[model samples]
Target: MAALLAAALAVTGCTAAEPGAAPRAEDARPTVISVTDGDVDLAILGEVYARVLTSGGYDVQLEIHSAQDPVSSADRLLAGEADFIVGCTGELLADFNPAGAEEIIDQWPELEEEGVGGFVVYDELIASLPSRLSATDPSSATSCDDAAEEQGLTQQVVPIFGATLFDREQREALTGITRLITTADLEDMEEAAEETGSVVEAVDEWVLDNEARSGGAFEDDREDVSYLYTP
Candidate 1:
């Protein structure tokens, strides 16, 4: 995972701006470091976010860390090494409050088969989080039941971040991404990477195509992404 992250970063050239640099009015937002776990799917989700934020005129970096290591993404955020992360609600809640997560999971036994809204535990999950961290609105691209069967907990993809990492506009922009991407989109991205033989190119192409189709507010730049070809 570390190696893969390094490769992605190298391809994207996602470096912070030089110190003491003057900021243009349109690009004055603070630099953002988006972190993710070892899971490839989450990493892709995180990349999609980093790109959207970048399109919104912020400098963003993506980092991947081992989920179970002492130096995890949450640890990095707590230590101020990162600003935000893409996370699944139930799994994240379970990490922080296992007993509470189990209780919530137990309440919903018959999971729905179609795309659904937020899980029963979402509100509780937000309320239980530390004051320093905040979660954005959950995505309906996945539901608790499907996540429970595969991950033992509800796993809706959402952005968890430092409480004040983004201002109102930035937060809204991030939330818009959750609304735009769906489970089928994730599958398409994965399949595109396989077909193109270059994960970086595949993601870039998908983002471009989707932005056009959805008339998305965000604009994507191929030059901003470093991975044009697989190593």
Candidate 2:
């Protein structure tokens, strides 16, 4: 499972046609931007933003680094080494407050105003076990498997991401695990268990089946099943 997760992370990590290709001398003043490292989707998005800015008559320079150590990048922006930092709202919030940096523009209004959500998944069997399993005594033969059969339950998939959950620790831990099949909310758990095998379908299906009542759980993003799915 760990190997599978590492593979997934590798597949998702950023790649570029050319690293740090600067514009010609005659181009407009460069607009440098930095993004969190290891986040492939955000890295690609940052590159796209840089290209767009360059085409719009602004020379662009983009850098990718780890959010775990973002202070130096933020310092670059403040000291004029870079023009902007592309990162999560939390980073912006922290930097803006401490460094007195003002936002020239916000590309993602949704993140600025509404915030993001996370995805979560859990083992379906956890809920199906006999009530006796909850007993304080460990001498009982009860187990997660026993609960799975007693409830005639089927294994289900859950999805989670960073921005949604209130707990950052839990979210980070989930990122390292190959299989996470539970949700923080019980209602979401029930809805996910009902979906069973079709967890990878459209977001609208999840919304219709779970979100309205479950108060918005994680949306499924599993494209390859060999990692977590077991038949």
Candidate 3:
């Protein structure tokens, strides 16, 4: 693991594409997914997805939201300004209107108003402190009145996003990729990213360890591409 970590750090860390490094696109434009917001776990998830996308031979560009709000990010996605978004905290919205959204299970009352309600997008469980979350977890309850009744939350849940990728192929490729990620596993990668000061390095190590479970989501056919992210 240490050797893998070191090697990953070397390859991806402290390097940028040399001047005019690209061979330039001669065919159809490479698909662009504008993943947003720089919260630690959100950024980490984006980086993980970016890694997977590049592995499948799609060109990806990651950008921070200048506005950094879910409404704006989602608007961007619909407008085609952004392709993907990893939303966290203030950036996400829990809608109170229309009586629809994902439900966030095991959620705290105080936090009920703060999270996006309706559907949980990832498989990571949001921790007692909300340091962890996954795609499969519900977004959170929509109504505070409803929450006080249904909620058994000692902790708050974070909303994880489903595929939402613009490219049909990338979306299809990542299906069933969610695996159970314990709090310990999340912290391990997060701590490693912080220690190395490299989200890419830590994610690379994680992908190496978990790829089989992900159905080769991290396997790279395009050697020329690499994506960088910060949390």
Candidate 4:
């Protein structure tokens, strides 16, 4: 996995900025970023982030890794080539800290108990890897039922960091974006994306609605998510 990540990053090691088509105000110096992750679904989520932040007047450049695992994607962030990377809890746990991977098991106690959005357990995922490789509905196609008992383990998705140093303002931007998504909302958005014939548009609309919400699920009272990654 590490080698694959390295190879992928090496092949695509360059900043990809959004064109100046809808450029921000003249005084605006948007923070250019390359958002990356392994899954296409997560890539769409990155687009959601880009759409929301851009509308909020933040200069953001979005990039999709077009890969299947986030190992290299996170590596992109740590290397300063990308500003943001989002991955599932399981993916973050394994590759968030290349120097101290054991921290994945130590932190994120919720992974040991249950995953957010009813994500199946890791062991079960391993058990069904062969079939999962070809499954259409990736999330629900897991063979994590009675057949894979005693091997179930949940892996929730979350943003992680520690290896990178950020200035005060960058730090604020990084930590300020709270978890605005829920399981049902995610499923609905996924379906809507398919129905509307445009995943990017669906995600953009959802981000706008979430931003418009006042003190809703993703609001001012949101909490820090670093603990989900660090000890």
Output the number of the TM-score-best candidate.
1
TM-score versus the correct structure, for each prediction: 0.71, 0.29, 0.51, 0.49
- Quick one: best lDDT, which candidate? 1
Q: How far is candidate 2 from the true structure (C-alpha RMSD, Å)?
A: 21.6
Q: Judged by lDDT against the true structure, how good is candidate 1?
A: 0.59
Candidate 3, residue 135: the lDDT equals 29
Candidate-wise lDDT, in order: 0.59, 0.31, 0.42, 0.39
- The window of 10 residues in a row where model 4 has the poorest summed lDDT is 222-231
Error of 3 at 231 (Å): 13
Q: What TM-score does candidate 3 get on C-alpha atoms? A: 0.51
- TM-score of predicted model 1? 0.71
What tens-digit string does per-residue lDDT give for candidate 1 at 1-231?
222221222212223223354432323333444444445567677677766656544456566555455665656666666667677787677766778877766665544333222456677778877886777788866533444576565577788876655544445555666767787777777787668765566677767777654335445543453321111
Worst 10 residues of 1 by lDDT: 4-13
lDDT string for model 3 (83-179, tens) is: 4454432223332211112234434343447653322312222222122112233322121223224333222223233222222333223433322
| Pick by TM-score: 1 or 4, better one | 1
Q: Please list the residue runs of candidate 1 whose C-alpha ends up more than 4 Å from where it truly belongs after superposition.
A: 1-37, 67-70, 110-118, 143-147, 213-216, 222-231
lDDT of 1 at 203: 72
Clash pairs, candidate 4, are 30-59, 88-157, 89-156, 89-157, 121-153
Give lDDT tens digits, candidate 2, residues 138-162: 1111112332343322212221111
